[model samples]
Target: MKMTPHENTKQFPALAPGPPRMFAPQTSTAVSRPKKNSTACLACKAAKRKCSGPDAPCKACRSTNTECHFDPSRDLRRKVAVKRTIQELTNHKDLLESLLSTLGSADQLQFDKVMDLIRKKAPFQDIAHAVGSPATTFGDPQELSNASKLAILEYGENHIETSGNGVRRPSDPGNIASSPEEIPNMKPPQWPTVSPYARVTLESLCDIPLFEVPAKPWTKVTDDDYLVSHLVSLYFTWDHPCTQFLDQRIFLQHMKLGDRRSEFCTPLLVNSLLSMASTYSDSPDVFSTPENVFSRGQNFFHEAQKLWEVEDDDHDLPNIQALLLMCCVFKCQGRVKKSWMMLSQAVRLAQDIGLFDTPAVSKKKMLPEMERVRTITAWGVFNMSSQMSIELQKIAPLEYPTSDVKLCGNEDFDWTPYPRSNKITYDKKPARLPEVREGLAELTRTLVDVQNLVSEKRRGTNLDELWRKAQDPFDRLTAWLQRWPSVPEIQPNPVPQVLLLRIKCLQAIIHLFEILNDPHQPQSVRQARFYQVKSVEETAQCLRIHRQSYGLKHIPSQIVDAIQTGLRILVPQLEESDESRQAFAELCRFGTALSHRFMQTADVIHEIRKNALHLGVRLPPEVIAIFDDPEQWRSLEP
Candidate 1:
């Protein structure tokens, strides 16, 4: 069969060598050919343009005035073959080098057939070089650069540097800039030192145990969300350090991006910052403080204020609650006007959003404290205005009271028969007096309305209603007091409005007692009235003291002075008549129980102010004179 295959190739040899016999090329036809133009030579295929062959410039290139030289190296027929052969040899060399680097002699032998095929195709010069030089030298510089880059990525700045200056060096050890320790020999900073009352740490303040798990288990002792909410609540409590965490750089770093935790924690964080700022503003120990803390706190408050204003609908309640806490801090710091404005805004927001009327069946229980705050604020305004009026009266006495008295009748009529009692009669009204009386009545009415609303079972109504009621009475009272007429009789009853108020209060108390005494009333009602009586009495006592302190003579000055002297006398006569004992008891029931302690504090303050006072007194001589005289000393004994 092998002989038959060879015999077939021999017999077919005729088909291989008869190409000289032509089918149609024997005839010589005189075909008219177009003349080739030397000025417009065909472009070379590789360069896509005409080229001058061997000559310095061809006719076409010279006509175009372009530089022209034939690329003698562009041998179309043989170029591809030469390039392919060189590429094949180079590729084989690279493959062998890769194999040798990764494997030993046995493995290298596996590529022997591939090496032999490459040797057969390669030129003699190439074969000699491949045998003489190892394949390792053929390693590409591009590969080296790529490997170096990968190493740099993994090891981070541990690299060697190759410079154009022919210097090969390791990267500077001190210049290792990838890690936190890049700054040489620097120790990590210690946690900031803080005062015991001032210092607040995240761990100490937060129940972070709740945040330990990814998913909140229904049966767990505490879950993450619940813990977070509780932490927020704690942060809002008075003087809590949870606020400090907001401004901490470390805390911010830990609050990872794309995390929902920060959104839930925002209200607490904002509130805490506001509180810290307020505390700094309010603290009395200014000498031992850092200025930056106060400034930082103020900045935080401003930032929080902006954030709170733009709160999303879902977070509106928490946001408002945070704002309310800020208002409280402002109030406590004596920034009354600012606090009132903030509180007004908060109340408006609560009403507009219907937060006050939120069903109790919802997650959060409605807080009664908000209504309580509003009531206290209203009272504060009233008290502040009243105090201011009293001060104005002291400094600038009303001229009408000090002016000469004129009779309305002629000399024949003796109009002095009826003695003036100095008391303004509420029953019979005068022209100017009615306005004052009406104003006082309006204030009383307003106070009653506020008291009633406050006493109701703590449902949030329109806070603006209470505020408007408060403002109307306050404005009227202020205007009336400021323009109060000064008659001769009025001077005797300096604060006629206050006197009238006292009388009305006493009447209310009497009515309340009557209600309590009624057998038809419920025991709870009676008990409530009893408490009301105590409160009213306490209020009356305070008003009495206030009037006395202002130098008003609605109650006789002699009676007030005697009472003060009698209190001192009764101190040693502790076992005096029940009446005297009752007087002492009454004084104690009022704020006078700590009068001695207050007096001591006052004496210290007075000592500081003595040099500043306009009037001078010989205190040492007076004291010595009093102590030197036995009778005077005996008289001073309690």
Candidate 2:
């Protein structure tokens, strides 16, 4: 307060402010501190504590009285190791691509050779050489370990086709492509695909269960997987066209996948199929003993029977199939009564499953192929029961199925050529079209009505009423014949069902005339004597077709029943003329020729002889000789 302005300015000159100097306000902002670059000591790193620096004992270690340690080579970030791993993976991927390209361009023979070597568990170097790779490329011992090579060989061995000698040979050169130049010219293999109506087939195949022969269910039939495969294949080749109740593709797919839980295949069904197919196989194991041809397939039949008795699902599709096949086995073995009973049970089960109902009303959801199978199976039961009823002169247990199921065509099924043996050429499968089944079903339905009419006649129904009832069925049959013209001759035609249907129609027509021209109830519709003449003429025509037909052994078993019916009508006319007797004898000889293979045909010959004697009709010496020869009718194996 006392000092002057000049003296105060001189004393505090350093603190003197400039004229109107402006200062900005300072605001506090939270800024994070930068991370330290110094590495931690071993003790600090292990404890996950902060360190001062790498000069000596770090602050953390010094505080804890621990020694400080650090290795310059240690990479705490692991960046170098990650980079090495990525490089190795890239190299491995490149190697796989190169190998795949080389293999993709190899011819089939060369590919097969390489695969064979791999299956033999050859060294990786040898395999690489076989695949046409340069020795130096994969020559490093560390590239492929022996264990890795063995693993690859194990995978290859599982898929290779090993021979009976337990060695896999290279594929036949003749069967493989010749030159790599032809690769561009090669066409894709033509495999069967699902029809438009059966779009669900591909899905069904994908849903198939894995195949395991050693699994519990399959072991109940046989331990040998090959035996099961062979028998199943033979059934499709020989017996499938005869009935076709089961869908071959679906059934085989289930078997191939080895899923025992699949609804399509079961031990009962497989064993039953084996029983039926055993009749056609030449294997000694199919027989109970070498001396007993009659015992053929008995082992499989017994196993199937045991399964059938224990089967829990009475309404299942495969169960119904097993029952039907069992019926056929009984028929083949000449157990007519047992066959009829089994057929009755199968019909009842099919009904219980509501197979006769429309798919919309069905309780169980199904695949398209399974729906087709059910439809076909329903028709099969009806046709089979109706046929047996006519042949046995009894009433059919099952009625016509009312479901609006579309009949399947050949395209609905797999017609892959079947291999019979180790033969190079496969047996050509015959065409079994749905049209044949349609015609047969139409013809069979009419015959069933006619059969009912015959039964009523035997029960002492009014002749006029019976004849009036017969007119409708007779007209229906006549119309059926015109729609399906009879085959002129039985050459080696593929569609034998056509010829077989014609024969059945002719047989029914003959029966229709027999009822119309009954001596007790005569009508003015046609001459009674002409009925006998016409019947004989048609019967002679059937005999001629049967005698000349090539590959009679391969025809459907139902054809045998048709022949039996024709023979029954013709046997009574033997005494009418010598020419008739000679023709009958010739047919008998031809039939006996097939009897050794088809036991049912032999039963038919014996029944004809028994019926002839019952009718007191005298046979010629040659006809009697044909019947008397034990070799002709002997069911025992040769």
- Candidate achieving the largest lDDT: 2
RMSD (CA, Å), candidate 1 to true, equals 42.6
At residue 210, candidate 2 shows an lDDT of 20
lDDT per model, in order? 0.35, 0.61
In candidate 1, residue 243 scores what lDDT? 13
TM-score per candidate, chains pooled: 0.23, 0.57
Off by over 4 Å in 1: 1-269, 272-289, 292-296, 356-638
What are the RMSDs of all candidates, in order? 42.6, 32.5
lDDT of 2 by residue, 48-83 (tens): 777776777777777878888864324323334334
Candidate 1 has an lDDT of 0.35
**What digit string (tens of lDDT, one per residue) describes model 1 on residues 309-424?**
67666644445455555654454333455655665665555545443333222334434433232222222223222222221221211111111111111111111100111322
Consecutive 10-residue window with the lowest summed lDDT within model 1: 409-418
Clashes of 2: 7
TM-score of 2: 0.57
